[model samples]
Target: MLKPRMIEEKMLILLRQGKISKWFSGIGQEAISVGVTKAMQEDEYILPMHRNLGVFTSRNIPLYRLFSQWQGKASGFTKGRDRSFHFGTQEYKIVGMISHLGPQLGVADGIALAHKLKNEKKLSAVFTGEGGTSEGDFHEALNIAAVWDLPVLFCIENNGYGLSTPTIEQYRCKDLADRGPGYGIESHIIDGNNIIEVFEKISELAQSIRNEPRPILIEFKTFRMRGHEEASGTKYVPEELMEEWGDKDPIINFENYLLQEGILNEEKIKGFRKSIKKEIDENLHKAFSENIIESDTSQEIADVYETYDHQEIISKSNKENIRFVDAISQALKQSLERHYDLVFMGQDIADYGGVFKITEGFMGEFGKDRVRNTPICESAVVGTAMGLSIKGMKAMVEMQFSDFVSSGFNPIVNYLAKVKYRWDQKADVVIRMPCGGGVGAGPFHSQTNEAWFTKVPGLKVIYPAFPYDAKGLLNTAFNDPNPVLFFEHKALYRSVRQDVPVDYYTLPFGKSSRIKEGEQISIITYGAGVHWALDTLEEMNFAGADLLDLRSLQPLDLEGICASVNKTGKAIILTEDSLAGSFASEIAALISEHCFESLDAPVLRVGSLETPIPFAQTLEREYLPKERFKNKLQELIEY
Candidate 1:
């Protein structure tokens, strides 16, 4: 406790000196971090918040490396890509917290779920502030953890203020732990300032959790002695309250007790402080001398996604015609059979098979452990997948509809998308999105939101039009060590059919398939737009057209797109998403930039009207780009 307190004090000095970028001081609340971390086993993972510097120190992370991390040096855990405790280190068995405080709780639940699935006697501990308890992720994580009886220590460091807001405004309950009973979880409240009390209680609870494998919520009642961050001063805090909490300082109280008990003397304390100061100074000096990270676009791009050796997939002589939905089910079954660590999770996916019946008999075939049903908690479920990925297990999450992705957006865009680039952690999770319109599902259920994910880095967006591509690309997505959003069009689930290979086959991403070839114009599209373009060309008997289906959007087939565009000299990009800020616009920009000299006419784009999809069939037709695409193609050919 004293060691981390001293380290934090030194960091503050460095922060004021402009040596380090920022610091979240855990000065008065050291006992909670120190005590909880010390109680956990070396192998048990702990997901820590920014203020929990003692957790890292207690876990024995090298002082030099941590100093380097704060200094944004090349030797840092995140290679200087992230700052403060915004990065995680797998080597130390510590998953660092993202800026969003509540999400890590769900991540902790995932790690615990992995342990339970492996039948291991391990548990995961996660920290959050009292204010973070208000987030929906908090309730979702607690509820899911209780439902699954996962081995997790849900630690809430109830520091009096959340930024500037006091506990009075944060919650209605007297204590944060009181809410645990509502989730059917065992709850406790402890004196976070007392190191001995915090240590003994946490140790007991952790052991019980490992033995019983259930979630427990423990609130460490403490106060933050410093501001939220170094820059945010404590002027908002009342002087009396600060003085009262300052008098109850954990380190001073512990020191006083040690002195009275003859465990430490003034001279011994001074010597200890002197030794710690020297250690911190030496490590800081070393960190200061370390080279700053230099920008390398090539290396930065390479690090965004993990590389995989593409292998040619051999197909069996026998093939069977199947619906797009069946192809997806077959792919998942094959993947589950191949990878023991792979787990499938979604709402009503177990016995119910799923809303689209994608996993019809998955539970009976793979058992409940592999094929699991989750509550309607998108944030927690997505976060759990991330945690499982961190544990070296692959997870498949089915968002019932792509529209609901907004609920799970934080974990997907913030954590899973940036995990590999931040700390070289592979987020081996695939989100199955049943998207698109033409059905009467309306705007809430049917949305072509692939462009939203495609714009984000560190995410693979796969939108397949055919059953073969759906199955083949899914296999590729499962094999890739990154997060993939596999968009399955709900409208084409039953309408589309193809003689897919009976044997397991993989397709490489960033490769486009030429459905038909011509020289006059190129019709480039993906997802439902591919079908519309094919029909339009066939209807017009347009022999002078090139039809291309881009299977993957992130690792996009730029070479294939440029080849067709350069050959045809005229192209039309079509998509189901709206025109403004559409992926079609991005494709047009790329074509114009790469094929300017080859172009005989300006590249045209066809997309849905900038309006929410309606329920009526006629209105939906008008809203989509099907008819517009045909007209646009003819206009391009004429031009």
Candidate 2:
């Protein structure tokens, strides 16, 4: 009864004191949180949403740390880079908490799947608000969880509003819990205001879900007495909402139950409130007055981000490396052979071998138990990877097309990206994405958006054009301590295949490969589009178009790029992604800043024009930097 009020009071205090910049409230929504947490085992895993402050506190996220995070203190989780609402403690087995509405469901599924595969007893519980239940990701997560029968408990806190949109407007269904049974999951609706009822119901549901190896959904019928956060207001809320829900306030209702059940006397209850208020006030002050950390933390953070460097030749057959896809296929083959803790998942990745056929023969090599095929739910695929990655397994997921990468954006950024850095945990995860624009594949299928991932710190972005590079990069990603998104150019999958080295070796990330060097112009690029830039140089009769393959995009070889620019005196940056704020933009800026005086023609940029890439095959080439390439030789000769 006191958990929600105390936390809300603390949040309000911190907000007014300017100690907490952001805080989500579960004031009237407490019983459900406290109930589920009470039902969950001390060591079982949980992925919480922002509103479940009571659950988090029970899970051992100290109020001060949470408060300090909200206050934007340096000591906060995410090194103060993340939001106050994002609270997690790996030591306590709270996998993570994300601000994204329903994505955690997928994350939980992944972990449960991994745990079950490894024969571990741990289960995963994910919490989300009523509003978040309607997303495609929500349905995706539930479907996978049911199919796998992963021991996961999904608790929905139906506070009636998905922000300002009411439940009636959000879904046509009468009960969110009812939808779970359709997915072969057991479910129940609980009176969230009644702590005893909630606790018992949650325990029963959690046991069933965990024991059956299937999921169970608990629709927590609660009300929000406070606003969404300390930042937002209740102005949009109707008067009748406040009036009708007043009787359903968990705190007030729970307190009455405690009194009726003789669990607490009036005087003792009053004393408890007073004590909680004082504790909250003191905690807020402490959270504010705590010491700060400086910027050198990332160096140590980077230092700690090391895994056991495990690179070994599994078989001559495994790695007399062949095609780019061969490296992927062999890597999966070797990964499956070497470690039973590995799982391969994605759309068409099982038997059909993915849309690019990258996972060909995987179903035969590793049976359904290990190499699982998924529905076309990229968000679910990645989210499940997050879960498995948490449970001490290496999960290699395939995103059918790089363009569809946006579907699982939340898990990639919030769950997969931040898990290790934020909670001091590990996510040995890799996402294989077929990327780049070329071969007249049209706009939807062809787009290189690695730049969207490049700016994201902690994630390693690998783009390999040849079979050898693919083999090396896959090794690097598998060995990497953090999450890695390995971008395989679909055009290059069958288009190019160099006989790779027999030895198990890895090309270090952030290094550039110079295919050829020339003095006239340095054609700096990555992926399949770079091939065109190279071809253009020859077609235009430029004797010197220095082609440097940017194999690693995130840890860009600035020194290499600088050296090339200094030698060539002219440069042209080409990329197939959108023109604005693209990788080309970054490279151009880097050259201008470092090798500015050496520039001959304002550093020519050959990239897709600043517009949505059109669908027509002929128009696609036209949209790219043809003039920069067409006039390359002429421009160089003039220079």
Candidate 3:
């Protein structure tokens, strides 16, 4: 507690000196953060908010690194990308929270779920401000934690005000803990200024959770004496209220309690304060002296893809005919059987086998512990998978349908896609999205939405058309150290079957497979379009057209597309998404930029109609008809 206070005091001087930019002081409420953290086991995870510097110090984060991170030095936790307390270390089992506070609570549920699945007697604790309780993720996280009986502790630091908004303006409840019972979790309120009371209550609650594996919400009724940040003046806080809270300062009260109990004398107190000051000074100097390095590599590549050691996949003895849907099940089964760290999470996945029956029989094969069902909360499902990934565990999350991903869009694009580049952390998560049209599922369920994810950096987008590619690419995605968006075409699930390799095999991303070779026109596409392009070519019996299938969108196979275009001197790009700013447009632009001189005619692009997919089969086919794309291909060949 003294360490954080002392560091904050010294760092505030740095901020004034222009050596640091932002600083959050946990001045008046250090006891709650320190108390809850000090009581936790070392292996247990504690994701601290920016104000919870006491928790960071309690977890033994080095003062030099913390100061360096504050200074935005190259040697800092995030290599200077993150500011203030927005950093975490896997070695210390600390996950950092972003400026947006409530999402980490859902992620903490994931960490706790991992512990439960592994049968580890450990818990995950997450800190948030009173204002954070109003966010939807806070409610979603708590509800899932209750439903799953996860060992998680949500410590709400109710400091009476959220920056400038008072508690009365924030929520109607007298206490934030009162809302926990509504979610079926026990709630408690305690005098956060008293260190002993805070520690004892948290220790008892943590122990009970470890035994029974359930969530508990604890609201530490404390106060933040300082403004939200150093620059944010506390002019809005009435002086009377400030003085009242100042007298109840946690450090001063704890110090007095220790002295009156004869636990510490004046000499020891002076020595402790002096020692911390000296340490802070030395570390502060080290932080400012370090250099800062910045790079635009992620922007240049549009993303960062992980390269791993080549592990030989075990293959089955004989090949067998398998549907694309069955191949996905087999791939998941293979991954779980091979890697103990791998876990599967989705809605109705464990017992009901998901809406598509893709994960059918997984519960019986792997048990309820590994093949688990999640609530309808998409953000929690995706966010928790990130938590599991941070712990060096492989997690495969099913989105149920691609369209529903709009709910979890923030964590998916913001955190999961940026984790590897932002902090050099490998977020090895695969989100299996059932996508594409022609299923008569309408706009809510039958949308092909790969374009939205392809634009996000630090994310790998893989869409396979065949059962062979589905099984192989999925296994490959599992081994990559980057987050992968694995898109499965709903139409192709049962429509296509080939002699699949009944063994462990993996396929590389950014590699295009040639469906056929031709001389006049080259056609490129993916997902459902790949099969459609093949059928159209067979129907036309045109030996003058070439077909290429791009398996991944992020690390796009530009070389293959350019080579085919150069050979044929004409090209056509196909996709299931609408033509306006579609992935096909990006491909067409690439061809025009690279193979412009080789082209004999203008590059043509074809895609679905610019509108939501309709439920009627006739409208759906017209939306992304095979004849429409074939007509464009024939026009390109004629040109």
Candidate 4:
């Protein structure tokens, strides 16, 4: 192995020579990245940190493209939206690069989970700085990865500090790798500067993880060679630090040993550097020639995602129809049949057909290749699904329970939802959040978070009330070239049954479904709430009370709300989501402005109380729709 001292010096030459600009040099810590990357299979992925340029050589990412990215060029993946060091590629299986603390772990979990579910014989190698292990997402990803037995190699390059903060100030542990066992993950510690040791241990660790679904936390004890980046000054080091760390330079030490063993001669070492320098110069020239991604590489190659022929799945009956969940299942079936690249996944979605059995018989019909089951790892499932979507595979992923979505929020909100704006990359991903609260699953299982994601732009959130709407909305979701968070209410999964149209159809999104039109109160709700309000209104002949089922949440049909309220002189917003900052609150505020003159009273908002849900049925029933509240609705109608 060439000493990291040589590699680090050569990298500095590349940077100063402008072969690559703004390099993150692992001056004192080259062994870990280089050793582990070299030990791993050439085809396997290893998403390293900025300092892991040595690993890039092992992974075969052209130095020119890497430099192009750092310089903020379209020729590289930064695509202008990403910082040079914070991006990854699909073709290369680098998965993703996020400069944010611990974001790469989630992507690693995603890639690993996808391989496990799809039965792909591959692994996802994810690296992080030791300091990042303290981040919340790191812990979350590790826990889920361990539980699901994901083939994830989490390399924590313990380079002493996170920018200015020392590791001791952040972590109380002697070795961060020890934290892995609590999550049932296998872990180890290595002298980061020792190439042979790092290479051997990492090779064994990766093979172990790939053979069995488990996470390996390898802590590499090393030091940064320079400041975090070129702009940051490295003058802060103590005087003794230079001599002490310099004596242990892995690159220099390794080169001496290799020469002593005749594995490398001085002439061979010089020739290697000469060849590498030439390669770096050539890569830079190639990167400089290609146009940056600002003008739409995705658009130019847009025809690839155009596998579907756009067959409209229109509903014949808007008056009477099927349960929303059934419609969703039928539409999913149609999408699978129509789109050859489409795939479906969820916990128990295959053998058990999901907890609600919405996907019953799907595994048998589509086979394991298209329909599959996954371990209970939402982030991994969602992350993997987004990756496949990015690769032009249409994915319909489901959360066994909507409440579990928070487990996967980072990828859904930060990555899948914004990948397009970030890289101008289209994520044809549909995440089905099974929500609504009627079930007695308690706080852990009964929460509604569609409103949470509805606030985020770039995500299409839909909450269909009827079966027909579910089918149509799902079809529409599949067609949309953006990320869609499709809400499948567990409460409404089998609550209603109606004969849906045999013909495939999808309802137009961003539109409200007027279940009933009246001159009285404009009752606005969606999902299960749409049924609750309609059932209540029909029992007593509030014949003039119009019921509006808002199918979509993100691109909310506020215009419909204003128009209905303006005529009725009253607006009532309902949701199973908590009252404060809930969907109802937004509707109330929207009505307050858009239909202010039309209000009979401050827009009445009905929803669960601002407390964690109770498992007991009686307490839950009394918790939200208190007797006084139900009576108040009746009193308002009588008035």
Candidate 5:
């Protein structure tokens, strides 16, 4: 606790000196971090809030790393890409908190799930503020934690304010812990200022969770003695409240308690304080002397962003007729049968199979523990899956409809995609989203949202058109070290059937499949668009057009695209996404940039109108009509 205080003081000095950008002070709330963390075992994981510097200090994280992190030095956990406590080290049992406070709660649930699956007597502890309790992720995480019976300790530092908002405005209940009963979990309110009491209560909670394996929510009633951060002034807090909490400061009270117990005299206390200050000061100087990361857009774009390597391996030797959805189910069955660490989670996936009935009979075969029916919470599920990955478990998360991804977009985009690059941690999580349109599921249930994920740097977006490709790609995704967003078109789930290999096989991520070879013009498409182009090509009379299916969206087969474009000398890009800022536009732009001189005609892009998919069948067909694509293809071929 004293070390955290000294580090806070040093950080404030650096903040004023313009050496560091900001600092989140745990001034009056040191007891909560110190006490709760002290109860946790070394193997247990911790997800600390921005203000919980004491938690890191208690966990034995070196002061120099903290100082270097805040100073944006290359030696920092995030390599200076992130600041403050927005960093993590896999070596330490700590997962650093980002500005988004609530999601970590869901992630902690995943870490607990991993420990439970591994039959390890360890737990995952996470911290959040009272204000963060209002976030949807908090509710989702708590609900799932209870449903899954995960060993997790949730600490809510009710510090009276979230930035400028106070507790009164945040919740109607007298205590945030009061809401835990609704989620079927044990909740308790503890004195935030009393270090010994906090430690004892947390120790009991940790033991109970480890023994019984259930989540416990504890509200540590404390106050923020300083502003939210260095940039945010404390003028919004009432003077009386500030002084009142100031008088009950944990560090000051703990010192008095130690002195009264003959733990230390005034001289010894002074010496200890001086020694801690010297350590912090020396580390601060050392961190300042460390190398700073210089921004290199080209290197970042060319080197660090790409995570895939091509491999040509076949899983199956013989072929058997199977539906696209069944192929996916087969791949999942293989994955679960092969790896005990793998868990399948989604809504109505167990017993009820799934809305699409893709996971039918999985529960009976794999058992309930392996095939889980999760609550209707996308964000929390994804976050928890990431947590499972962190604990050396592979998590397979299913988003019922790709359209619902918007609900959990933050964790998928911010946390899942950036985990590998930020901390060099393997986010071995696969999000299976049933995407695309044509089943009359309307805008809410049917959407081609692949473009949204393709724009993200670290995510691998897989959209397979054929059953063979679906099984192969999904199998590959299960073993891949990085995060993968596997998009299975709902329209093609049961509609498409083919003779797929029974044996295990894997396909390269960034490779393209040429369905037909031709001259004159080239058609680049994927998913439903692949069939749309092939079917339209059969009916239309064009000079001669080759159809290329880009299986992977992110690490695009630029080589295949350019080769086909160079031969044909003309191109037509097709997609089911909205024409305005679609992934198809990216393909078109690539051709215009790379194959500019080779082009004999302008590249033609065919996409749906910038309107939501309608429930009416005729309107839907008109929206993404095959005729429009044929018209564009014929025009490009003729030119």
Candidate 6:
């Protein structure tokens, strides 16, 4: 406890001297970090909040590397990508918190879920503050943890204030632990200032949880001795409250108790302080002298996705006619059989199958442990998939509809997408998104939201048009080390059928297939739009056109798109998304920029109307781009 306290004290001086950018002081709250961390087993994972600098120090992370992280040096854990305890280290079994306080709670549930599935007696511990209890993630995480009976120690540090807001304004309950009983979790409240009490209580709870594998909540009632950060001073706190808490400082009180017991004396304490100070000074000097990170586009791009050796999948002669949905189901079944560590999770996916019956009969084939059903908590389920991926298990999540992705957006875009670049952690998770319209399922159930994920870095976006492409791309998605968003068009689930290979195969991302070769114009599209373009071209008796299907959006077929445009010298990009900010616009922009000199006219784009998808069949038909695509292609051909 004193070691982290002394290191933080020196860090505070560095903050004052402008040697570091900022600091979130854990001055009076060191007991919670030190005690809780000490109580856990070394192999157990702990997700610490930003103020829990003591957790990092307690785990024996090198002072030079930590200081280097804070100083934004190249040798830091994040390679100068983030600051504070915002980065996680796989080596120390520490998953650090993001700026959003409550999300890590769900991640902790994920790690615990993995342990339980593997029949390991390991438990995970996660920390959050009193204010974080108000977040929806807090409720979702606790509910799922309780429902699944996962082994997780949820620690809440009730440090009197959330930034400047008092505890009175934060909640109506007497203590945060009071809400634990509502979730069917065992709850306890402890004196966070008393190091011995915190340690003993946490140790008992951890042991019980490990033995039985159930969720536990511990509320540590303590006070912050400094401002939220150095810049945000505690001026809003009453002077009387500050003075009262000042008298109860954990470090000073512990030192006095040790002295009274004759375990520590003035001379021995002085010597300990001298040695710690010397060590911190030398580390700070080394960290300060380290080279700063430089901007390298190639290196930055390389770090965005992990590299893997491509295995050429030989096409077998065995083929059978299958629907698009069947191809997806076959790919998932094959993946589950091949990878023993893969887990498939979604609402009603186990026994009831799924809303679309995509996973029908999966539970009987794979068992409940592998084909698991989840609550209606999208955020927690996504975070759990990420946690499973972090533990070397592959995870597949099914979004009933792409619209509900908004609820799980933070984990996918913030955590799963950024984990690799931030901490070199690969999240091998695939989120199956059933998107697009034509079945009159209304706005919420039908949407082509592929553009939302294509703009996000460190994510693979696959939108296949036919059954063959769907199965092949899915195989590649399951094998990739990065997070992938597999978009399956709802209308094409059963409407599209083709003779797909029964044997396993994989297709490379960023590669496009040319459906037909022509010279008059180039038609670029994907997903359902591919079928629309094919029908339109055949209906109009237009044979002089180059038709290209972009199977993946993020690792897009830029070279193929440019090549087609250069050959035809005229292009029309089509999509099911809205015209404004649609992916079609991006393709058009790329064509104009890369193949401008070879163009015969201005590039064209076709997309849905800029309005929410309506429930009425007529309204949806008028909104989609299928009718408008013919005119756009004609306009491009004439030009």
lDDT winner: 1
Cα RMSD (Å) between model 2 and the true structure?
A: 3.4
Candidate with more favorable, higher lDDT: 2 or 4: 2
Q: Rank the candidates by TM-score, best first.
A: 1, 6, 5, 3, 2, 4
For residues 54-79, what per-residue lDDT tens digits would candidate 4 score against the true structure?
A: 67656667666766776577667756
Predicted candidate 3 versus true structure: per-residue lDDT over 126-225, tens digit per residue: 9999999998889989998999898999999998789989999999977889999999999999899889999999999999998989999999998888
For residue 345, give model 3's deviation from the true position in Å: 1.0
lDDT (CA) per prediction: 0.92, 0.76, 0.86, 0.74, 0.87, 0.90
Considering summed lDDT, which 10 consecutive residues are worst modelled in model 3? 298-307
Provide the lDDT at 14 for model 1. Answer: 80
lDDT of 5 by residue, 1-639 (tens): 888887788778778988777778888888999998899997789999888988889988778887878777777787767778887777778998878888899989999988888788889999999889999999999999999898989899999998999888888987788888989999999999999999998898898888889999999989998888868989999999999988899989989989999998999989989999888878877887887779787755543342555455775478999999889988888888877889999999999999988889999998898889999999999999989888888889889898998999999889988877776677888999998888888889989999888988888899999999998888889878788999999889898999999977777788899988898789899999988887887777543778899999977899999999999899999999987889989999999999999999998899998899898989899888577998887677667
Model 2: lDDT of residue 561: 95
Q: Where in model 1 is the C-alpha error above 4 Å?
A: none
lDDT of 2 at 549: 92
User: How does residue 495 of candidate 2 score in lDDT?
Assistant: 70
> Clash pairs of candidate 6?
none
Native-vs-model 5 lDDT?
Answer: 0.87
Each prediction's TM-score versus the true structure: 0.99, 0.89, 0.96, 0.75, 0.97, 0.98
lDDT (Cα) of model 3:
0.86
Error of 1 at 31 (Å): 0.6
Q: Model 4 Cα displacement at 464 (Å)?
A: 1.2
Off by over 4 Å in 3: 294-305, 310-316
Total backbone collisions for each predicted model: 0, 8, 1, 18, 6, 0
Q: Which is the better candidate, 4 or 6, if ranked by TM-score?
A: 6
RMSD of each: 1.0, 3.4, 2.1, 5.8, 1.5, 1.1
Could you tell which candidate, 3 or 6, scores higher by TM-score?
A: 6
